[model samples]
Target: MIDIRLGGARPESAQGCVAVPVPAADGGAPVAITPGLLPDDVAAEAAAYLAETEHKGAAGSVQSLPRPLRQPSKLLLVGVGAGDEAGWRTAGAALARAAVREAELTVLAPAELTDAALRGLAEGLWLASYRFAMIEPKADAAPKLAQVTVAVAATPEREAALAAARTVSDLTRFARDLTNTPSQLKTPAWFVEQVLARTGARVTATVRDQDQLAAEGFGGILAVGGGSAQPPRLLQLSWAPEGATRHVVLVGKGITFDTGGIDIKPTEAMQLMRKDMGAAATVCATILAAAELDLPVRVTVLAPLAENMVSGSSWRSGDVVTHYGGLTSEVHSTDAEGRVVLADAMAYAVARLEPDLLLDLATLTGASRVALGKKTAAVFSDNEELVAGIGTAAAQAGELVWRLPLADEYVKDVAAEIADLNNAAGNPGAITAALYLREFAGPLRDRWLHVDMSAPSWSGGTDGELVKGATGWGVRTLVRWLQGLAA
Candidate 1:
């Protein structure tokens, strides 16, 4: 974790090292040195260093020459393009990478920068510093860099800024843990137990057996999980602060594994089925982080956990099921299990919590992934202002999200012949999934946003940029947005 602060001093000044704060692009003060002053050394010996700092085709080199009148053994400058905030963040990240490799005792981020820019630098550096080298065979150890010092020159506020950066780093790592855990280890039952273990929050868990599900009319859960030996469960976790300004409901799809049921996916596609619970992992982490942070806004987290498998018992296509909210759904594809379970979960949230805002996250569709790719998640909602606010928060959090259209007329595509709706609407699967959930969202629809995170929910071979297998994608963005709401 990185310790951030605001002050007027050089990072190396305290311990005999030096850092230069460069001016912003808009120009106020040449706050510090802008990486352009160092001589470029591009050679084979520096190949490893170049690999660590290069970005988007930019040449990364090391400057070995001791600048005239400099006391340090070597003077290094990381090139951040003139006044570009994005460039600054990249430069900060690159500097951290090089510093860690060379095992420097302390590195600095010059203060006299805006909160947003400082935070961006902190985030990039911290994220880049994360190492998931656990999976590989052990190598000869190198001396570790024990500390990072960000020089806060002329800025009086130091404590709060440092605390905020630490908070962001902690929450993100927590989310990564949930996503990284295997499905067998993170089952519905296990999820409840973990939440209870955390303490300091209200938790209610209900596991509906065959008879109980039938009696309560939660056809969505039963139909989706009937094939699996593990039955389905619905868990609700809440945290309320005294005199909370508003209540928010968060619904997460918790499919332990998705075999695509009868539709069945290729073996390669099924390899990472354990990651199907990515959305649930995000929600669980969010609620826990909120409780830990003691945020003043009341929050309720709802998770509908199940596994979609293959068996004679699995609900087949054309099956009609009645959900917990009394709405009927026709299953057109067993692979579309995400929307089915989420429909009931959303309904349960609105009916019980009646929150001022409603939000749900899931690895719901491949279409969404194709549309937005791994760098950004796609957001669909009926509420424009809420969408804008979320976008702002996403930018600040350093996570990317693009608002998509609800397309009111597309609502008709989900209409069912025998039920209130069809879980699989055949066209624009992701949008249809959001629409199905909206039907049961009730009054919360006006204050809702549906996030389809179908890509990068789980990393491939190795973890990169602060994520192992599970990226913990939404925690920071949601937390930042909630903070704004509280303000």
Candidate 2:
């Protein structure tokens, strides 16, 4: 984690690389670039460099000065396109990348730094500075920037914003670390242990092994995890503060590694299956962040941990199993196993927890990625208010989520002749998978929201704050949404 601190004004005098924001090409108001923000000689030199290089201020664009007339070792002209929150975040990330070799860095906050903007800048810096060196060989070279200072006005609101930013950044990185770990090292038991270790007094975590799962009738989880030598487990993390007004139950599909069981995936497709538990990592991170922030809401997380692998005892296609609420489902494809485990967890949440609002996330389908691309998660819900609220939260957090119609008419696609539903449907697979989970939502279907996060959970390449691996996509959105409920 990067040590980020609030610094005094005049970032040019700060150590290491000093990042200064430049407005976009079509920027409306003229942001005063005076000596007060940057030294007069340095500002003139930057303007000359920009003119020489034809540097139009577009978001995520950078221009570095190796020999600058300033106290700082180097100067960075970071582009703030349109001066929006997203643009500010992009600028912050760009600055981080440019200053990757620097041991210390400072970002000069713009004159119009609102609480939201400050949070965005801080998030970008911390997120971009993330490095996952768990298994990789250590480099003899000096590490990346160990400390970052954001030069902003010292106010109570700004301090609160910075605190929130730190919470999200740290938890998101935590999720990324869990998701990127090798599947062999991160099994069902390991996930439970990690959760228990991170949770505080406000949160109580309980784990139920295979024996308990069978007794509780979680057939879906049991069947999918039957092939793995390590037994399946159901982890329930609850945070119910006294006098809490609303109950929000979250279910995450925790497939530590997916090999498609009896119906195996191709060799090329099986490479990144370790990240199949991205949803579990995300929800756990959100709950931990909520506990840290002390949000006044009753939150419960149901994570069904399993590994979908192939063996003599592997669950085969056409096998029928009864889920938690007695809903029987036929296994059409083992690759569609995420929704299977989630079904049991969701049904259990509805039957036992009786939440005011229920949301489940899973890397459930490849068709979702094919349909929504890799940057946006597909959302499905019958409740308009819930959809709108999540949309607002996503916008505030700069996460992309697109709401697809529930299309109840297509429920028959997953309907089976011998069972209540089949795990896999033909075309429009994402919607059908969501519909399959909807059946387990019971009478409170309108209160349930299912997010198909297969697409956004991992990034193929570096983009702004998102790195090239597990993106930790949903944590910030969930945190912001839960915070809104508390508000």
Candidate 3:
């Protein structure tokens, strides 16, 4: 994990590389220096370098000056285009990549660093510093920057803002780590253990194994996991503080590994199936962060973990399984098993938890990726107010979420001849999948929101705050939403 701290010290006095922001001017090169906290000589040299090189200070651009730059080991001139929050985030990420080899770094906060800008900067640095070295071995080279100090004027509000930023960065990295781990090592049982270990004394966690799930009539989970040697698990994590006013239940689709069951996917499609559990990771990280922050709200998370493999016992197409709420689903395509497990969890959350608001996240359909591209997650809900709230929260957190309508006409696509729903809906698959999960939401259908995160769960390459893989897309949005409820 990357160590981040908030300090009142000026950037020029700090050791290691110091990132200085250069705000873009009207048309010519950048002329404004943020913070203006650098030493006189260092500041003059940076201005001269920019003028001599004609560095425009475009967003995401970096200009580096090696040693002999006054006091610091190096000077990094980062571009903050238009001096907006988004530009600051891009500048922070660019600084992180430029200072990859440095062991310690400091970023001078803009003189007017709003709470939003502070959050963006913190998120960028911590997110860009993430690297998964679990399975692959790394070279025995010099260590990357382990500590990052955001130099700002110390005050209660700034300190609180810094704390919030650190919390988001840490938990987002936690979710990323879970999503990046190899499926072989991160089984259903392993996921449960991780939840317990990371959330000790913060949240109450309980796990229901195969026998328990079967006894409880969780047909969706059982049928999906029956194909694999490792049985399924329904893990519940709860955080209920005294005087909590509202209850929110989050359901995550936790397919540890998907081989597409009897209907195996092509080799190219199955290669990244280890990240099928990205939704589970997001929910777990969100609830744990809420508990750590001691938010005054009751929160519960239901994660259905399974491994969809090809075997004699694998549930095949045309089979009908009765979900927890007595809604039967016809398995039209074995590859569409995420909605099946999620159905069971959603049903359980609605029937038992009776939450005021219910939200389920899943990487359930590739159609979502096709429709919304790779950066945005598709959100479906019948309630306009809930959707608006989600949109607001997502915007505030800098997470991209587009509200896809839940048209009643789309429900016909998932209608089964012999069952209440079908796993595979023909066209507009993402919308139909949400309709399928809506069946389990039952009486509280209007209170439910489904997030189809097929695309944003994993990144093809580095982008802004996203690292190479496991983007951890939904954690910040969920956290912000929950925080608003508490507020």
Candidate 4:
């Protein structure tokens, strides 16, 4: 993790050269650090790098100035593409990673930093700062980032900009911690307990255990998780809006760990199974954000959590399972457990909570990764307005979200031979999973959006702003979307 601080030297106090290093796009040049250049060096070198190299502020390019001359020793000037906020943020992340080798570093922002740019920079740093060292005994050898100096040219606005960046950093860290937890320690029960312990008067968390679920007819959760030793749970968290009529429902698939049940997953595929609860973590984090921001809109989050394990009691193929909303589903494949849990949670949220808009997220399908890849999150929904809102939110949050079609024609694959629907669809796995969830959502169909976050839920590579574990993909998107609605 990087420690951030304000620069001690104001523009008037500058006495030494600051290295304005340019990160070569193709690794063509060893990082060039111009010593003793100061702020003027940063400006001059940035222009020269941009004009000479025409760096598009592309993912690999340098984005910001690392103040090497300052007491911190190294100032990195990273080139964010074309002066855009996202570009600068991407650059900020690149610089953070490059500076990991340094004992500590400070980043100097341009004199006039917009709120958007500041926010992006903070988020990028947080994203890039995450390190998953739990499995590696030597992981602790990696030096911690001691400080980041968001040095804006000394002015009244400096304080505000720095303050804003700090706020964003705090929120980004909050989201990151939720996403980084391992499944073994972050089960549904544990998550609920944590929420109960964390939430104050403004938020409420309710967890329904196996016995309560059985009595309440939430069969979808029971049938899907029945095979595992860990019992199923439904965590409902809510906050009342102040003088607001609009309400939003957020649902997450909280499979604490997915072992593919009777249809076991391969060893490689099961390695990151702990991140299967990413959806749940995201929803929980978003709810906390909403409460923290005091959004004037009623919000309800439903996280249906369970461990998908193989056992004698596991639901088998061809078995008809009844859900909470009185819908019968045929269990064709036990591995398609995410949608099963989400189906019950979505229904409960829409019917019981009665939110005006619904959005649900899950690492539910491999097909989503195939469609959207690792950087972009796949979004499916019938409502264009909601989709637009989501798109805007993702843009603001500096996250990637691509809208995918939820074609009505594809809904047939979920139709079962003997039941109302099939838990596992025959084609378009990701889309079909969302389609399966739609059945239990009832009449609020147009207000719904489903995010298939299969790719971004966990990382195989430690790229810029992405750690090698759970990414906490949906937290920022959900928080931004809800905040936008509130505004």
lDDT agreement with native, every candidate: 0.69, 0.86, 0.86, 0.73
Model 4 accuracy (lDDT, Cα):
0.73
lDDT of 3 by residue, 1-487 (tens): 5677777466546676788888788866357675366877878888888887777878778889876744777888888777676787788788778888787888887667777777777777877777787555455553487888878766688777768878888999989988899988889999889878898786999899999998899999999999999989999999999999899999999999999999899999999999999999999999998988889989999999999998999999999998887889988999999999999998888888979999999998999889999989999998888888888888877788998878889878888899988899878888888888888889889899999998999999988878888988799999989988888
Cα lDDT, model 2, residue 196: 87
Worst window of 10 by summed lDDT in candidate 3? 134-143
Model 2: per-residue lDDT, tens digit, 98-143?
Answer: 8878888888776667888778888888888777756664565545
Highest TM-score scorer: 2
Runs in model 1 with CA error above 4 Å? 1-76, 79-92, 102-105, 131-137, 141-143, 153-156, 199-216, 459-468
Better of 3 and 4 by TM-score: 3
**Two-way TM-score contest, 1 vs 3, winner:** 3
Ranking by TM-score: 2, 3, 4, 1
- What does the lDDT come to for candidate 1? 0.69
Count backbone overlaps in model 2. Answer: 0
Model 2 per-residue lDDT at 373: 90
| Location of the lowest summed lDDT over 10 successive residues in candidate 4 | 15-24
Clash pairs, candidate 2, are: none
Among all windows of 10 consecutive residues in model 1, the one with the lowest summed lDDT is 55-64
